[model samples]
Target: MSTTAHSLDRLIDESVFAGRIYLDGEWIEGGGGEIASIEPATGETLAMVGVASAADVARAAEGAARAQREWAATPHPVRAGVLRRAGQLWEQHAEEIMGWNVREVGAIPPLAGFALHVTAAECYEASALPSAPLGQVLSSEEPRISLAEQVPVGVVGVISPFNVPLILGIRAVAPALALGNAVLLKPDPRTVITGGVSMVRIFEEAGLPAGLLQLVPGGAEVGEAMVSDPRVRVIAFTGSTRAGRAVGELAGRHLKRAHLELGGNSAFLVRADADVDQAVNLATWGAFLHQGQICMTVGRHIVHESLFDAYVEKLAAKAESMVVGDPAAGQVHLGPLIDEVQRDRVHTLVQDAVAQGAELRAGGTYEGLFYRPTVLANTPRDAAAYCDEVFGPVASVVSYSTDDEAVELASATDYGLSLGIVSKDALGALDLARRIPTGIVHINDQTVNDEANAPFGGTGSSGTGSRHGGVQANVDAFTETRWITLRREPGQYPL
Candidate 1:
């Protein structure tokens, strides 16, 4: 093994990556050819991961289906114990996982560490799900008792994105498993090792039964196979809006349960009464965290005209001050995007906005995949940067003359995932937050925020459904409620 590989082995169990796929309690070489896992920071081939063919997906689905009944029959406490152990294991190897995230995903230490912590926290939170109230007793008429009980929906197919692979995948996987559903996880091709292999090893070490959680590493074909399979009852996905729409449509056609946590071009509105320094800090973190590749990254900043100039100047300076470089080398506030395609996409959006009369106020240069944190001012409403999901280290400042205009500009986008409001008056921010159509709204904070115990999702094109974080997080998504009633006495009838 190379030095990097050897170092990684010391962090995580080396056996986890011995083969490409983890199916039926063993590692196996995939039918599909190998894929090169490239480190975005240095543009080097990190490792070769095996890709799963459609047949591999089919077999994994079959294994999950076969194991679903026995796994579901296990006591809830037993399931919770497994999840709790998995959380402990994650905590033990967190630094290693964080390091892998930095090297593989180009995530800054803070963001990478945050993702790792959240991933483990999700497991801990999900441990309580099996013991939560899954049903209720209702008063019934005509001398009868009515009761509703929750039951597992059987096998689930999980498709996660590359941006925050561990947390995104575990957000659904941990909950689904806790609720007695088998999961066939298909991680993003670029992050197969950290996203798929590592997770599988953690669960296995936690004493989960064979075939309960399967990892199939592959491309779009594998995802399609899992979605089309009749045995797979639910699909939990996190990715772009376009891809989520396709998955949603396919699930609808198949009449399968689907939970989608999709894209977002969230807005941050700075009221005239807001503190400029505080607002600038929130804007900087919201827009440039993870190079602004996050789904909830702030794409537009709507500030009152009175404070617009000051906000723009301060935000520009803040963006300019961000450290951008290889995340594996040293400390950095901003890191590279996933690859060249994403870098070019962000650059095109910025260039187009400038061409359309938007001023490039701060940073717009790049070295390889590392695009500097960029701030734009006076961006036209029709500019791509303002109208679309940039999904990069770019934020646009648009001035609003009135409160109505602020809300209007914030709601003008086709996506309505998250909204951030900064104001001195808490009541006023809350009042405005109600009027916004996004699924999640934060007062006096940034749009890019999440917790393991709160509901996290969006509206309009952002997501097809919501996924909560507490005990009830995946109950609705992974289980079906059955209503039952028993008659104490027979009804009178003429025979």
Candidate 2:
């Protein structure tokens, strides 16, 4: 093992990776070939993870289907107990898990730490779901009783993305398990260890029954098998808008329930009455955090014409001040993109924006996968950087003369994921927020924000359905309802 790998051993139990795939009760070899997990920070192979083939996906689905009945039969308290224990395990190994996130996914400390915290919180929050009332009685005619009860959707296929892997994966996995559904998780290939394997070990240690949760990591082939399988009842996906469209199409063809949390080009609007300094600070964090890989990152800034110049200058300085380098080196405000492809995509967008007359205000340089936090000013509405989802540390600023134009520009994008409004007038901000077409809007704050208790999802191209936190959100997505009626007496219309 290399020095970083050795450090990982000290962080979590070394046995977590001994066998790559977790099927049934055993950790076994994968049928697919091996994939090298490269560390984006150093362009080095951090580890070799076994990939899952179509056969491997089939086996996992079979195992989940076989175990669904018994697992669902398990009492709600017993299920809740397992989830609670898993949450405790997450808390116990928080540092190690966060370190894995940093090493494997190139996440800076703050974002990595936040992911760990929210993932653990999801476990705890999901525990309460099993005990909540899943059904209700309805008024009926005399001598008749009617009731509706919630039931498990059976096996769920979870395909999670590389960005925010832990929280995203667990947000689906934890809740599905709580609702008595089996999960076959296919994590992003780049983050298999932290995203898929870690959760398996945690659930196993928490005494979950065999075959309830399976981790199979692979590329698109494996994902296709999992999603197309007839045995899988529900699919929860988080990734780009393009890929999400494919998943949704497949789910529709199969008539399966699909919950998708897709892409976002969220906007940050600063009103003339807003505090420029505070808005700038929030925008800095929202745009550059995690190299702006977050789906909710502030991709566009629409500032009042009065404060546009000041906001641009302050934001440019802030972007320039951000440190982009190897996350493990310490105190890095921004880190490398997940890989070269993402870096190149971000660079192309910036270059194209500049070519189309946008001013490169600050920090448009790069070294390998590490790109500096970049700011673009006076970007036209039609420019790629301003119009599309730049999933990197790049922020586009534009000035608007009227509030209607500001709202129109913010709402004009194909995405309706998140919107941020900053203003000194709280009531006015709220009023504007109500008019924004996005799923979630923040007042006096930047676009990037998430909590375990909020309805954390998007609209239109952003997502197909909500992946809100808490038990209520899970129940709606992970289960089905059945209505039953009983007649206590015979009818007078008998023959």
Q: Any idea what lDDT model 2 has?
A: 0.88
| CA lDDT, candidate 1, residue 495 | 90
Q: Predict model 1's lDDT versus the native.
A: 0.88
Give the alpha-carbon lDDT of every model: 0.88, 0.88
- Model 2 segments beyond 4 Å from truth? 1-19, 489-495
Candidate 1 lDDT by residue in tens digits, 357-387: 9999998889999999999999999998988
TM-score between model 1 and native: 0.96
Q: Lowest-scoring 10 consecutive residues by lDDT in candidate 2? A: 2-11
Q: What TM-score does model 2 achieve against the real structure?
A: 0.96
lDDT by residue (295-333, candidate 2, tens digit) is 999999999999999999999998888788899888888
